[model samples]
Target chain A: MNAADLPSSCDLVVIGGGPAGLAAAALAARAGVQTVLFDENAGVGGQIYRGITATPVEDRAILGADYWAGVGLVDEARASGAVIVNGAIVWSLDPARRVGVSIAGKARLIQARQVIVATGSLERPLPIPGWTLPGVMTAGAAQTALKAQGLVPDGRTVMAGAGPLLWLLAAQLLRAGAKIEAILDTAPRMNWLRAAWHLPDFALSPYWSKGLALLREVKAKVPVIRVDRVEAHGRDRFAEVAFGSASGERRMKADLLLLHHGVVPNVNLALAAGVAHRWNGRQLCFEPVVDQDFGTSIPGIAVAGDGAGIAGGTAAAERGRIAAIAAVAALKPDAILPQVQAIRQRLAREEMGRAFLDVLYQPAPGHRRPVGDTIVCRCEEVTARQVRDAADLGCEGPNQMKAFLRCGMGPCQGRLCGLTVTELIAEQRRSNPAEVGYYRLRPPVKPISLAELASLPISDAERKAVER
Target chain B: MFKRLGSTGTEVMLKVDGKPVRARSGDTVAAALLAAGIDHCRTTPVTGAPRAPYCLMGVCFDCLVTIDGVGSRQGCLVPVREGMAVETQLGRREAGR
Candidate 1:
């Protein structure tokens, strides 16, 4: 995890240390290709298996079996002898497969013949009134705190919005002895019809049992209300949550408000890497366009994990392995073909139940495009009305919206608000999100401190070349 | 504000704006601050309103704080260390060379 023996270049560089990246790096290393894995987190396991090495057996039990299952994977990865670099934030991944990395506040570039992008996904933005309040947080945030630090909400936490994570968190917290006031489910009642249509595939797959268990645990302990409209109201911090149901609106006092509509691919790194991306309507997120075997439009660059799409952790790991097999085979002509074939078979099997989950957890249309004065860009505080108004004035795409309103310009750099803006613009223009387009990402993809940039360890010759 | 579940880890003491906060050894700066009832991690540059960690992961970047004099570090990602000095990252400011 140190940069002490780090190299300036490698045969293959994997960006992200999540399930996919871990599998990719381990496989490539095992195949004898010089590999290096970069992760921003302190540990290797991504969000799903976060703190796996640190959490005790009893603690693992509380996190459930799916998380505990990753222990073996992490062990296998560590045994692979890959050069693992933790705390390395990949700021720029260009088309030429050059990765600009910042480690311990120092900047360096990694030149790789091939790069695997497995940056994973972010929670779908849940924009509502009082969402920016100090007590408001995404369900992923709550889960990350718990997974990484074993922290659980100490006060009356009101869980809102919809998605698998919403119910899963409620179940987890209930097990942790945390106080949960209620759950405001935002999925349409009609979504059951859509979910039922895919039930056959879901029942035959591995996720069915786990999904049912989460639902059972949440229903047995918590009061669940099915609703569409929700808003958090407070002065300084979140004081209460107001939501609507078929029975009409209801209000409840809350110490914390955790929101999550769903998750979407965190494609900033991939997009910044100059890969082609298409917006996925079913998942309501932008995903990189990768061909079968995870090779991006650009050769030698592959994307896996939720960064390519929200295929869950199990499938993401398989996809990662598949991408690794493919990339390594291309790099090393003598690489075994049978290994790649076996991984493909596993990946296909692992991907079976995704349709059911996607249909069942598809967020309500209201969430994708919030109406009224709901804020779309949290960083700049641009409202839906303002974005719609801009679109009404012939605003064409998200990039232009950025110029007019600064929607994607923030410390977060469009991660939180980009999809919302695209959806908003698409809604006004009467086109789909893909046709409406996305933000043109520029480097450094992650904002590097000026101090770090100035102190970049360029040799005098390299500096002179740049000066020339 | 949160607490550990299932098991206990070793505890570490850190400071937030000169105020002492006790946290588990592996607790992120944001988690420690939250456990100590300090919700407002930073003030925004645009509105000057108090903001805490929205996404405990690095995606939101709302948890930015000064850790050991390094400005704009994500509090939710930085593990708590003994005697670490923390400050709220508020507004636009220049970093000195």
Candidate 2:
């Protein structure tokens, strides 16, 4: 936990502190391995359970029971004696199991025998025009603001997007005293058609009542606006929004415009580490390929939690535990059992609820690959037309487009544009997203100061090895 | 867009561009600024247009600001301390001491 005297190596280096990372690191360390978990946040709750440790909201009702569910697991991890280093950003990972990290601006390199990446998911790229305007942000952003800092959206606030999180956020916002505007639902029609067939399955699942209740509450107070298409419009800050609803094109003025299509696995670190990933059509994002053991394509590296794929916090914790048990077995064969029966039973139950949720919350089809001057890349302000032109000019994928139009080469590092870029190229080339491929991710995954790099304490052995 | 939902935490005083701003004990620099009616956090490097804390979770770089003489720190991520000085980030970072 000492940034000044950080270990050059450890047994396991779990790269996130969300539900999965915390579970994996805690279990692995308790199973007799030197495990250290690094999270960029000051606390351990990943995005889903963000600010659980430091949530300023005294009334937990504002956050709901599902969010509070992870509290026990977080407490367990905190008590498990795993070295939890918050505010430690892992910027790079090498094949040799070396992790480059910045802990409160001090840089260090930690080598590990086994690495588990449970970095978790990010809000999907909502590339509607004027999305980059000052007041426009993701639903997750607004939720994080409320949860982490107890700040509520003032003025007229409009919530737009699909999924349970969007509704949950709306409910929480209403409780926080945010002014009413409308909830523009961009959820795909196919989900509604498919949801009924799977409704029985969802009802039987444990999360059934919770999800339904959230939906009911949001629908009760807020005026749900179903829009065929939605776009934020403003010059300095988002002043108004234009969208086509059931009636026709309409414009509404709002102060804060929060947008969320869905979430995607945060795979920048995984891709940079050369972990194999496959495009998940249902989720519409690339998830790292992991076996039942949660081991990724590379040996000594396991991926768990929503970072591997978005299964939410509960499933992520189960996946993390499964990965930890498998990791300990891999490292110290005698320590693990032939089969973790109880854990498997729990995991099975946790997984049942996920299928129906994923099906129901998938982003609307049109929203994924937007049309008509929609800005695909918010950082560089690249449009769908420009990306198609790049493809027409023989640009094969995101990398080629990067060279051709500087689409994915921005400060946000394609986080807001990677998926859209891939889809755009895929559409133009008459192929699928997997065929078009994703941007070649590199590290420092998050930015690191040049001064911090220059100040890394080179051990005597490292200096000697470098000379050779 | 900002309002404090609860008053459990103690208040702390900080400065934004030499103006004293009051914030709670656990409030982030971005939250304090937003609560104080300061909408624009920084201006874009290329277009020179204003930007704010779009993503409070440190993912979006739009909340970049100079904190305690350090440049390009995401205002949402940095917890506010008493008497801390924060300035709007301008363009690319200069190596700060």
Question: Tens digits of per-residue lDDT for model 1 on A1-468?
Answer: 444357878999998888999999989888888999998887879888887777532644567888887887787788988888888889998889988888888888778999999899889898887889888999988888787777889889988888877887888778778889888888888888988988888888888888888888888878888887889888878888999867898889889999988889998888887899987777778788888889998889999988898878988899989899888888998975446677777777777788878888788878778878887888787889999999999999999998899988987889988988888888899998889888999888777988777756688998899795
Model 1, residue A246: C-alpha shift (Å): 3.4
Clash list (residue pairs), candidate 2: none
Superposition-based RMSD of candidate 1 using all C-alpha atoms, in angstroms:
1.7
Task: Report how closely model 1 matches the true complex, as a DockQ value.
Answer: 0.69
Q: Each predicted complex: what DockQ?
A: 0.69, 0.71
Cα lDDT tens digits, model 2, A65-179, are 8889878878888787788998888999877788999887889988889999988888998878788888898899889888887889888999888887888899999877887
Docking class of 1: medium
Global local distance difference test of model 2 = 0.84
* Per-residue lDDT of model 2, residues B1-97, tens digit only: 7888877588899989999999988788888888888878787666676888887877777888999998888788788899999998766666562
Native contact recovery (fnat) for each candidate is 0.72, 0.70
Model 2 CA deviation exceeding 4 Å by range: A336-339, A461-468, B95-97
